[model samples]
Target: MSESTPFRAAAAGRPVAISIRNVSQRFGDAGSPNEVVAVDDMSLDVRRGEFVCLLGPSGCGKSTLLNIVGGLFPATDGVVMVGDKPVKGPLPRDISFVFQESTLFPWYTIRENFDVAFKFQNVAKSEWASRTKQALEAVNMGAFIDHYPNQLSVGMRQRVNLARGIALGTDIILMDEPFAALDEQTRMVLGEDLSELLAKTGKTIVFVTHSLAEAVFLSDRIFVMTARPGRIKSIIEVDEPHPRSPDFMLTPKFSELRNQAYALLRDEVRQAIALAREAEAAHA
Candidate 1:
């Protein structure tokens, strides 16, 4: 999506919980013929309890940026700070991640999968049951706690995945298109659930999504990005408080914002295509 002007949230006065400065990511060696730069020098701050969406054209390194912030991988340049500390590796206590695919092991029951995650995070054995119960209940998946991952539909499996991430009790969550695979109706329902959950828990979330409507629905502010070697193209503000309803989508304001984001993205997608063709010609 596109915006002509960048609007940084002015003086809401919330403390910055995560500070990302001039972050860039590259694969392979510098200047090598095969080298690919996925992220340019992009920087932004995510405040406590805010939900920020990264929206951009395909291959724009949205997931790459998420991994860097989560410390699942290192950046080629710049730095990410969680609170006052620099992110060097997975910060399990402060950050958690949810992926597009179901991360639950097929053999494990829904309850058991959560137990495994809790064990890895080294939560006390006593807290696992209570935490697991609470998280499942929040997503309305409590009844299926005994079901195996494969037994559930894709939507249900994803719901369990979301519950597991929230159950981890991290103050910050980095999600890489967690709802991308779902059908529109399922995604909308889950988006509603997420908004409500965010209101209750007040965790900071950096969500990556390709859906313009989804971005508008769930984010406090959307970070529209450039093409490959992605950087912030513009930041679009929703100006709505969380626990947003489906009714919001039917409003005039929502349509305007959706069109605006789509307009911004259209040119970037064309540019990305042209660049791809040039690279192909060079290699050919």
Candidate 2:
């Protein structure tokens, strides 16, 4: 697609939320044997209010692509545009990140954690309370507002972590394996809740996950990546509408799509492992 192509044509009336044009990321200087080209010449367009998932094997640079989109790291080549503006640095007011590890302050209460995040975003003190409350309620974490991070379960902590991201009130949210640490049951529940929340809020979300099922269940489209140096192998459209139900999980369509993604990734994953082993052998 051309640079002028809309990120999400369906949501064109809304806005072009994120545009990644031929972006690449390399971790070392030229001529270095140890240099790793993490991401290679990938382009994607994410529209406002759309949910896109980056699905790839470990070391396939899914996170690298997300970091470039979030402006957490600069791309070695190509450009990232958020809402038509080039992303040069961390756009705190426009982007919020939910990492794999809970970023909540263990020392502070949940309410306090939100307060500090809002403070960092320079949201007015007067608006903090209401925004914090509203966000917590949206994630169903409102009742635990006064609880400290250590007192919460892994699932609960993630709820608070998600709330903190939402409380930032940013247009785009980038999540990197945010539910990977939770048990399968917890992850399922959280995934359902997240789907519902996305449907209601219409927030543009770009999530990175290894779960084939999660990608099929939650994303409008899933970007299946190749092994490192990572490239876009294929993009799978889920076709299922959001606010998806557990019943959807048991259907043939879901299983069929999941299998398709696995088939596309199996060889790449094996190749990635073989490459790692070769590198290790050379080092030894």
Candidate 3:
């Protein structure tokens, strides 16, 4: 059996919010020369209200696994469950995504962008204005409702993107390196805001991030993966509570956990580099 089964079994007693069972994703037809197995035989359960981080080297399939969970597409093998239901396609009401870059329409005002999202989600027209206002306010972007995406700074645009996800009223949020493009300072501040939002909303979140400090500070647990054909290498737990402050980062425990995650990842990252080099030489 695969590594994930044991972990899933261990967490069976908890209220699982997302369950992935032996999922694998391949980029090409099976046995084809171009076939690339991005994820291999992975299984794990995300518990209700938990913040889980998928952390690994650059080419590992962290984001791919997240996409499967969000029903962006079906996995090549195995199944994913959101609660007890199988995910056949996007469950807009139950799941939302905040991507690395802002997905806001360039021509629309911030309010119009949210209206579009709600409309797609089949949210009632009467509730659009109130929900949009509340979500924007939550991200401290309420005053910019009339602004276009181009009018906002990169960080502000991301904040709006996050608000759009939140306003969708989904119970689960999948974030694909949402703060990736920001400077370190802005990323940290947004991390704080996300932590606070998590505490307030109790949403089940699955985040993909490469930053060790960001993972250590924001996650309830971190899933460290292997070099490629990514599988869980180890799981690291952070016992801190949410709405975490900057002071938490200064703690000895923070340093210890961060070091633990790094140590687990170091060899895998080296392996990934070697694999990349081999692939390059083969193509050449």
RMSD of each: 2.6, 2.2, 2.4
Candidate 2 local distance difference test against the native? 0.87
Runs of candidate 1 exceeding 4 Å displacement: 1-11, 279-284
- Candidate 3 deviates by what RMSD? 2.4
State the lDDT of candidate 1 residue by residue for 35-94, as single tens digits.
888999988888888899999988888999999999998999999999999999999889
Higher-scoring candidate on lDDT, 2 or 3:
3
**Model 1 residue 122 lDDT?**
76
Q: What are the lDDT figures for the candidates, one per model?
A: 0.89, 0.87, 0.90
Residue-by-residue lDDT tens digits, candidate 3, 82-141:
999999999988999999999999999999999999988888899999999999998889
In model 1, state the lDDT of residue 81: 96
- Output candidate 2 Cα RMSD: 2.2
TM-score on alpha carbons, each prediction: 0.94, 0.94, 0.95
Clashing pairs in 2: none
